[model samples]
Every structure is written in C-alpha cells, then in structure tokens.
Target: MTRCRLCGSTALESVVDLGATPPCESFLAAERLDAPEPTYPLHLRVCTDCWLAQIPPLITPEETFSEYAYFSSYSSSWVEHARVFVEDAAARLGLGEDSFVVEVASNDGYLLRHVVDRGVRCLGVEPSVNVGAAAREAGVPTLTAFLSPETGAAVRAEHGPADLVVANNVYAHIPDVIGFTKGLRALVADDGWVSVEVQHLLTLIEENQYDTIYHEHFQYYTVASAIRALASGGLTLVDVELLPTHGGSLRLWARPEEAAGEPGRRVADVLAREKAAGLQELSGYTEFSARVAKVRRDLLRFLVDAAEEGRTVVGYGAPGKGNTLLNHCGIRPDLLPYTVDRNPYKHGRYTPGTRIPVLPPERIAADRPDYVLVLPWNLRAELVEQLAYVHEWGGRLVFPIPELSIVEVER
Candidate 1:
C-alpha cells in the first residue's frame, strides 16, 4: 500500500480509483500514435490520520512538465483570471517598483505580465522550457527550473526575498508538498505573504470532479489539510478565499510562523463549512466512488445514444481533465470523432489515451457537427459563448461532468 504522500500515514483509505491512465498532458503526434504509451494507476487515497487526500507520484515532474504542452495563455478566460489576480494582489500587498515579486510555476507569463506592467519587479520560476521560453519572449523574467528549497534560496539570494510570492494552481501538481511549501517559506519576506491556489478537494467530491485526478496532480487539499500541510513547512495559514476558477479553488494566504496572526473570519467560515460537509471524517468519502462511477455511465449513455440516433458529436478544448474523463470512460474517436483546441501545439496532436484527433476550432463551423461536446465543462460558459455560432445551425452544446446535460442555446 502506498503511504500517504502528505502525512506519511499508513492508514490510507481508497476514495476513488480511476484505473490506469496515461499522463494526461501527453498529447500524441500522428507518428507516435502507434508507439506504446505508458500508463500508471490513478487512485485517490485519504489518510485517516490527517484526512489529506493524495495520489502517489508514479511519474516525475521532469516527465510531466519539462516539455509541457498546455499553455495558460491559450484560454482567454484563464488569462483574464490571472490578470485580475495580479491586479488584486498587487494592491492588497501595496506593491511598488521596489517590491520584488516571484511567481512559482508561472506559465507563459500569463499573470506576471500584469505585475511588470504595474512597475512591480517580479521573477517567474517555470520548469517547462517551452512555456518558460514563451515567458522570456514575452519579456517576463523567468528561470527555467522547478521551484525547490535550493532554487528558492538561489532566487532569494539573487533577487532578494520576495515582498509577495504567488503560486496559482501548482500546489497540487507538486509531489514533494512539504518541500514546495518550505521553498515558499524561503522565498517570501518576513512581513510578506505567500498566496497559493489549489482546486478545493471538497468541491472535487461534491461536484464529481474526478476528471481533475491525473498523474500530474499528486494531492487534493481541503482547508484543514492545506493548513496542516503548510504548517509542516514552517508557514501558517492566515486567510483563505474560495475562488470559482478551475471548477473551485482555494486561495490560501500564509505568513511565517513567527508572525503573530489569527485565522481570519473567512478561514473560520470555510473550515466550518468543510467540517459541516464531513471533510474531517473517513465516512464522508464512502459514497464518492459510487458517484464518480455514475458519471462514467451517464456520459457513456449520452454519447452512445447520440451515435445511435445518427447524430454527429465533436468536442471542444483538449484539456488534461478532458483527457482523463475521456480515457476513464473508454471513449474513442468512434463516439467523439474529433475535438478542437485553440493552442497551436495541441492542434495537430491527438488526445493521450482516447486517440481522438484534435483540430482547430474553425473546423467545428466548417464541419457543423450536430452536437459539440464541451469537454472542459468547468469552462462551459466561456466555451458556449465562444462557440455560440453553432446555434445558428440548430446545434447545441453538451456537458459530461457532474451530470450529463445538453446546454440549451438561444436561437
């Protein structure tokens, strides 16, 4: 049995098993489709001791992120989210030209550009050469190395301890959660703050967001477990904000343990809500696996019905979560003949396990498929609006997560 990654507890209980899946981000080129793809067991386990939901790191960060495919700037909604975060964080931190800011896992300078535009000095630490080079090309100062205690110390030495440290959506991707948190401790100034955002585990279970579970994300965190994990690295959680991004995420605010601080009302409120939702106990997770199983059945039934009725279905957005959902449900090009993505890198590539060909979004209009399956259901609103022209042909959008539903488009 794999011990809990966060707390190292022996009492790890299975929450949900996604079975064997390939690295979600490994989009295959036409030539590589015949090559044998490696797959790893994707199972979520919760530690009874600490209630930290985690998955073993079957794949290394180098294999997953070094030459990454997903670019944050591809999604305009995500870029806007980053821009808004930078604006709000800068004002809240009282940032200035002298204030040094560092963003860990800064993907393609999507957020840091806003920081630099405001005259705040910032550095981005990105492990992926592809995205890091893009960040550099975009004029955001970037280091092509994973953030660790060693790298964080080097960053502090050369750039000075950061007045503000931002880590968005990378907290769960880290295998060494404690080491990453310690690096955050090393990177931030004494009076400064570290803001980390992760998809909230509570939301994952409630919304049947098992699609987010892949080899890349090593752990899922709730308020209680996140506070515990952060404390292990000499940081203290002082505040938290529930964000609507990435399904649902928690923006955690922390300072060094020496700082005298009390948990804010928001923190207490969320904790209370988590506790009320039974996040503190093992029994709360008992029904999760069954719920996740239902999603697979629901989605497959919908797709099979569409095919039987001679309806053509295509997909939008080739995200990692979409790949997971597709692979787990045993979907292939037969049900979803092809998909579309805006990222040029993924345009010619096929989805990891399902081998569904990905094309450009313009093809959707040209082909005019009867139903467009919105794979990235979290961004359903944005996708619906972006592909609203499909409604002109009496086509509607379909969502496959939480529950399978057909989106009603206003004609």
Candidate 2:
C-alpha cells in the first residue's frame, strides 16, 4: 500500500499470495444465472513498522457488506463463544443498565443480546440491512449504517458516547482503517476504552490459515501495528490480551490520548515477541507464500485423488472462510460434489466461488457420502457429534486444515 493501513508507515513487505479468488460472500443468486464469475488477486502484506498483516484493496466496505450473507447464529460454537464473551465482559467492564455499549459489525446481535438481557443500554452498528434487522428483532438498538466519522457523530448525538465498545473480529473488515479508528475515537466516551479482537497475524502464518484472506478482511492488525493505527486517531493502547479463540487472536483495549492508566505489560511483551519473530523486518513475510502453496497442493491432492476413485466427498458449513479455502484451492463440484449448512439464508444457495451446492445438513445422512469434509473445522466437536450417525454406515469425516485428518467413528 502507499502507507501502512495500521500505522500510515510507508514501509511494507509483500508476503503470501492467496492467488486470485472471488469475494467470499458473492454467493451465486438467481440473478447471476448466466453471469460471469469474477475473481480478484487475493494477496497479503506485512507492515515493516507495525507487523500488521493486510491485503491490497480490491473492494470497498459499501461494495463488500451492502448485501452481507454471513450470520453468526448459524455457528453454534460462535454463539457459545459470544455467550462466554458477554459474561466475561459484563464482569470486567462492570456495565449496568445506564452504561451504553455499542458493537460495530454486530452481525445478527449474537453478542449484544447478552448486554440487552442485562438491562444495559446497547446499540449495534451494522451496515447490512438483513443483519441489522436481525439485531433489531433480537431487541438490540440497531444503527443500520456503516460506522464513519460523520455517522459516529450522529450516533453520539443521539445515543450518546458509549461507555464500552466491543468489536469482535471486525477490526480487519474495514477498508478505511484510519477512518474507522478515528470513528472509534469519536464514538467511545472520553475515558471509555474500545476492545477490538482480530485474528493474530503470527497465528495465521504458523497455522497456514491462508483461507482467511477474503475481500472483507481488509486490514489485519498486530499489536505493534495497531498501536500506530490507534495513535493516528488520538487513541492509545491501554491493555492487550491474548485470546485462544479464533485460532489465536488479540483483544486490544484502547482509549483517547488524555485517558489515564499505563499501557499493560502484555502490550510490551507481545511487541517483544513480534520483534524476536522478526515482524519488525520485511523478511518475515517472504517465506509465507511457499507455506501457503504447500497447503494448497496437499489439500488439492487429497480431494482430487478421492474424486478420481469415485469416492464421493461432501462438505459441511458454508462459512466465508470455507469459501476462501475452496476458491484458493480451486475446489469445485468435481472434487467435492456438494456441501451443507444450517443457515436457511445459505441453504439452497451455492457457495460463492466454488459453485458447490449448499444443501441442508440433514442431506449428509440422506446421501451418506464416503467422506464428509468439515469446512468449518473450528466446530469439529459439534459437527462430529451431530453427524455421529455416519458411524452406522462406516462413513468418515475429513478435516483438511491446520493438518489433514480423518475422524473415524466406531461401529
């Protein structure tokens, strides 16, 4: 980029190439029956100063989320994750009915419901109309617009500055990284801090999570890089926490410049770790593309080999992450005949780039394919339990990421 999205630093290094892939959420609709599928270069970069992992801009927030498709409630594990976060945050923030809370990119009110249940005043800033409506139905005060400096001012004038701001996994979703952080500064109270959770860039490299590189996840954040980004908006890093969830993420707390309280030791420790890991230098990113390519070769080899033998393989979960995986690996109906999902919105629709038919998950038992691929491997436990019936027919579940494995069920 011209300057680092996180720090405005001009020094950046090109890292892994996810190759060209379609936008993860561009699921084929009836209107696209005869239309051509579009794919853009899916690549990631690392900041020499901030160590933030990021992708070159191919789309905008308005274009990416105007008709959003992902819904949080569809993932049982994520819902439980949200519940736990709600409980812990309530205790930590000591929030009560009068304290206002806001969550940007509040998909379907999965997290805000707990705040509402606690009788706390809360609002959800969601750009997608469909998801915004879902939050409204769930009793959250929903602001159906993209959060910007102007929008944040309007929201503050009406709803007042938030006592707490929670942005889960959405910190990387904004194209205007600087603008969004500035808006965050405007929306939060003078002393109130904003906690943002983003997938750790180091983990993405170590675990070979190239599939996370989709159109929406515009700017990835590392603590070193995030500090610079936050500072651009008159905010300072207050504390940082390492979260095991989402394959290792960082929960960073930040407040305006004049806010009191020293930066936590975690911030310094993580920064040191990144430096030791060479995140402050450009060479750290150069080797990632080879690792990603290896993953692609291995996964494609396994799937295509199974297909050639006439051993049918079906997939589970229509997550955006899965879409990126499918597209980057060039997986289509040949290697994987079809996939299934729990979300009614995605059911009966095809996965965006792969064109893999998305049926109701119940179809798995109906067809009893030789191998059931778990697309969203994060929910392996629930998926295996729900599909335990496969054991009766000598069927097995296959998970290809982090490492390829077969979940064999006893007869």
What is every candidate's alpha-carbon RMSD to the true fold?
0.9, 1.8
Task: Report the lDDT tens digits of candidate 2 across residue range 1-411.
Answer: 677766677877788777788888877865675788888888777767667777878888888787788888877778888888878887888888789999999989998988888899998999999988988988888888988888888889999999888888888998787788888888999988798888887677677777777888987667788888788778899899887766678998898889847898889999887777766777666777888788788888888898789888899888888998898888988898889888888766788777888888789888889999888876777788887888988889988777778889663
Q: What are the per-model numbers of colliding residue pairs? A: 0, 1
Off by over 4 Å in 1: none
lDDT of each: 0.91, 0.83
lDDT of 1: 0.91
Q: Give the per-residue lDDT of model 1 (tens digit) for 260-363.
A: 38989999999998998888998789999999999999989989998999999999989999989999999999999999999999988999989999999899
TM-score of every candidate: 0.99, 0.95
Off by over 4 Å in 2: 7-10
In angstroms, the error of model 1 at 339 is 0.5
Provide the global lDDT of candidate 2 against the true structure: 0.83
The model with the greatest lDDT is 1
What number of backbone clashes does candidate 1 have, counting pairs of residues 3 or more apart or in separate chains? 0
